[model samples]
Target: MARPKVPRLSADRIADAAIELIDSGAPFGVNALARSLGVTPSSLYNHIDGRDGIIELVRGRLGRRYLPELPTGTWDEIVVETMQGMRRLYAEHPAIVPLLVGKTITDDAVIESYDVLATALVDGGFPDDEVLSVVAVLDSFALGFGLDYASPDDIWQPGTPTRSLGRLIATAERGDARSDRVFELGLELVLDALRLRLARLRDD
Candidate 1:
């Protein structure tokens, strides 16, 4: 008798199929994906635990490919470079914007990147606890900007302006400027606010 044929299914392969569906701008529910893969919905369980597992796989890929390696320059340089890298990543994987918005960064690759960034912030004078807060702000801003950029409503808008200062001017004229400058300005404002608070702490 011939040996039974084993179904071809793996976490990576399943993730790839899901990503392809996402790329096509189609819904990526388990049933639709199972149909596309020519496998029963239960077959996916052999590869991934469930929908969350598939989402984790996608998030892992997105983080590894998009998160920038820590920069070796000034703290400001590292911050700017990292933010720019994130912006580019979201631009390339627009379909994954929602995932980026609320996804937890539990993947080792993502955690390592966060560690590097957080370490940089600590070295730049932020308290360890504050580093995570700063990271959260930057990540949120980058994701929000990417979503705005990728929206069909803004597809016809002019490209994001290059110069940071020029962004404010471009936005005033109805052009969608890059959010890096705005983010930087916000960071500065936060730093100023922190400094004031710290001063009060020291005075007390």
Candidate 2:
């Protein structure tokens, strides 16, 4: 009798497995993943071209889940909503947050989502050249904030257990109003500055 042939895995299946592993806080490595999937490491090549391909697939999945059609609203409202959405998505997939911060936008879905926001800014009288710069600033701030918020106790190192924000705050001397008040004040200041810049550009 002939030996039975193994089933071939599709790229989507491999990507799905990788995502599940990452979301479960497992270290995403080829050897371990191949073992988990009951295939040789070489089998992954039939699915993903390489590690970068895997990263792109993961990013695509994240973008699909998080980057919905943004609502038609004022620029500030859109920014706030986009930031909130990004924060929620990053929190759910903390393992991939670092990848998001360091990697370039390789996934088409991710790129398109960003383009939608940039187009909105351009339509709102912002210059085309500055739209992407503004978006980069806003996205970097949101990602940094989300990472800090999600991993409050982690001592900025890999393989370390994260600390709770409450514990860290308890060490500080209690005196002034909420720290978040300061954050809100700073946000308002930035918005005001942005508005002034827009006004000056329009006047010119």
Candidate 3:
């Protein structure tokens, strides 16, 4: 009788399995991941530090795939590009957002992306005290837009005829196009506000 060929298990394999499990809206855990990988729970510890490790691995995978290396450009350009990329990343893996936010980010690649954003804001005249606040605003804005992007095409379904939003929903475009327009408009508003803040800081 031929022996069974067990699939090789590694950190990357663990990460991939965890992502698929999360993407499927399944409850994720070391046992769940190990089962998905056809391995014993103890076997997983050989490659990861357990739950937190798995989360970081998933984050790294998503980051490498969707996050950008902020390019040489104006601060606004850097921010727009970074935010757009972050939104796409989360939009594609909305399930991972909750997992990621619940932990302190320890992934080097993920940290580097923020480092770039921080450097750009600082170089662009934002004070050290305000750098993280700016980053937080951008982070929250991108995550919100990302969740919005993942939402159903029909954002609103008015059961009965009424004024205001119901009427607007009747004619408004649904899906990606509408979401894209709103996201861009929101970005513009944010950027304009940041510019005003920068000007005020310099004047003060």
Best by TM-score: 3
* Model 3 ranges off by over 4 Å: 1-7, 68-70, 158-163
> Over all chains combined, what TM-score does candidate 3 have?
0.90
Model 2: colliding residue pairs: 153-163, 154-163
lDDT of 2 at 5: 89
Off by over 4 Å in 1: 1-7, 68-73, 151-204
For model 1, name the residue pairs that clash: none
lDDT to native, each model: 0.68, 0.70, 0.89
Candidate 2 deviant stretches above 4 angstroms = 1-12, 151-190
- The TM-scores of all predictions, comma-separated, are 0.67, 0.71, 0.90
Q: What's the lDDT for residue 164 in model 3? A: 95
Local error of candidate 2 at residue 92 (angstroms): 2.4
**Model 2 collision count:** 2
Cα lDDT, model 2, residue 108: 88
Clash count for candidate 3 is 0
Per-residue CA lDDT of candidate 3, range 1-204, in tens? 676597478667788899999999998999998999899999999888989999999988888878645455888998998998999988888998999999999999989889988999999999999999999999999999999977798877878777798878878888999989999999999999999999999999
**C-alpha root-mean-square deviation, each candidate:** 6.5, 7.3, 2.9
Q: By TM-score, highest first, what's the ranking?
A: 3, 2, 1
- Model 1 root mean square deviation, Cα atoms: 6.5
Model 2 lDDT tens row, 1-204:
675586567766776788788888877777766877889989887777677787788887777777666546777767666766775677567788776667677888778777777877788889988988999877876665555444334333334455675565555433223323433565576668778989999999
